[model samples]
Target: MVNDIIADERSPVSASGHAYGEAERREANLIYEYADHLQRHGHRVARQLIQIPGEPRPHRTDLYDTSTNRLIEAKGTLHREAVRLAIGQLFDYRRFLSPEPALGLLLPAKPSADILELCRALGVKIIWQEGGGFTESSGG
Candidate 1:
């Protein structure tokens, strides 16, 4: 199982462990850029480690922006599978969080319209990197 690691309050999630694959490197960069963006906007971003009743390990959120009451799960790609994984992760992370917070999917770029609509229906915000900033589509 993936370890639910924690990030320092001052930094975003690190690559951790050994070396990173090409894909993993991209994801790590995404997190760092996103974290910086949040900080620039005066948002408090941190990662949460949650343990389930029967789980052997905890789960970690990609980014929890307390400033906006938002919990985000991020992926490096806009592929259908990546978005699907982020959506599921957001739900799982939200379940164990107090005050729940709004859910968001963080991606390298915008997804298809259908995916955005699905997220809207499920009340999951879509956040994507655009130019030097980020674009957000609030959930329904």
Candidate 2:
């Protein structure tokens, strides 16, 4: 089932992980893990590479599910400030990859309700850790 879902060229796990900054790379790994989790549940998952024209370079999305073609931007942090920063980054990514509604997953350290609310208002989906792993409740 997992193998079937990830049978695509854009799947993240299908290719080698990028060599981002230490912290960024760690966060990317977590997103990859979440993608693996979703794949285990029989969902097709892919990762997007976002490149804003005239920008510094391109940034990769946490995960993108082929089943739903849902673009997910993952944010992880122990501090509220860091989480906020991640949210901002995700928003930027969404804008760059406009037209497709993006989902934000808060891992380990969750974002505040205010941030979550903002995401809701902006039509960005939210997912977070509940127990042993993460779960998606909206933006299917």
Candidate 3:
């Protein structure tokens, strides 16, 4: 439901419609900052909308690198619950992308060691904000 909520947030609706709390808003800002950072690094970033057959609505991925087939899912935090949700989203988005790119997670900060381990086990690259740039963990 997070995706659905966020999708609504992109529209002109009541705050209660999206219902993203403070942490969620902060995380959304991080995604914007991350996208700008990537642009400065020469990576063309764009949102990818995935439309499933017979589905009335489509799902949107946060950022995708057109130059390099990389799909990125951004999170405000890499806490346990956020990571879990991101993993599911990355997988779902990947299936719909043409040529299915490599998947990555963008976070405001590095997560706990255990969470990083979980990402590695799932084969999702971890990229966290560092200073004004981003650091890649290349999770196992």
Candidate 4:
């Protein structure tokens, strides 16, 4: 699912023929690594695709933990813009997810206090790297 999105978003070279290099690819790899961490900890994870209304091609979610019914949106950074983007995507994708799983945002590290507050206000769980492993907050 993620591969499809990466393929669609590919635009390595612009009109100027300058290569914008590995940022996107690295972000994808980061998400995959996070997914792997979940699986290693005994979570049953899968990449999910949501069929957009009136759209032929579906949108893919970063990770879905079937056992816990968590829908996670992975972001390479937890800055304000990235956090906002992930929140919006998660909310939009939820409408198409059956049974309405718990929403979560997976980040490389903990976000700013404001970002954390926003997720808490929206009732979105936050999973971020801390020390040598990942940490989670209920976003309550």
Q: Which ten residues in a row have the lowest lDDT in candidate 3?
A: 1-10
Q: Which residue pairs does candidate 3 place in steric collision?
A: none
Q: What tens digits encode model 2's per-residue C-alpha lDDT throughout 17-107? A: 7534555545655666677777778887765678788879566666777776567666555455765666677767767664655456546
How many steric clashes does model 1 contain?
A: 0
In order of TM-score, best first, we have: 3, 1, 4, 2
Q: State the lDDT of candidate 3 residue by residue for 1-140, as single tens digits.
A: 22322343264333688656666777677777777777777877777888988989887778787778889888887678888999899998888878979888888887888888888898888989888688988663
TM-score of 1: 0.83
lDDT string for model 1 (1-140, tens) is: 01222342223334574454555557766777887877777877778878888999777667788798888887877888888888888887788888988998888888899999999999998888898799998664
Candidate 3 TM-score versus the reference: 0.84
Which ranges of candidate 3 are over 4 A from the true structure? 1-9, 12-18
Over 1-140, each residue of candidate 4 has an lDDT whose tens digit, in order, gives: 33433334336775678875454455676667766777788877777878887998788787788889989887776568878899999999988888988999988788888888889999899988788778888563
Task: Give residue 83's error in model 3 in angstroms.
Answer: 0.7
Q: Of the candidates numbered 2 and 4, which has the greater lDDT value?
A: 4
Q: Which 10 consecutive residues of model 4 have the lowest summed lDDT?
A: 1-10
Score candidate 2 by TM-score against the native: 0.63
Which 10 consecutive positions of candidate 1 have the poorest summed lDDT?
Answer: 1-10
Clashing residue pairs, backbone N/CA/C < 3 A, model 4? none
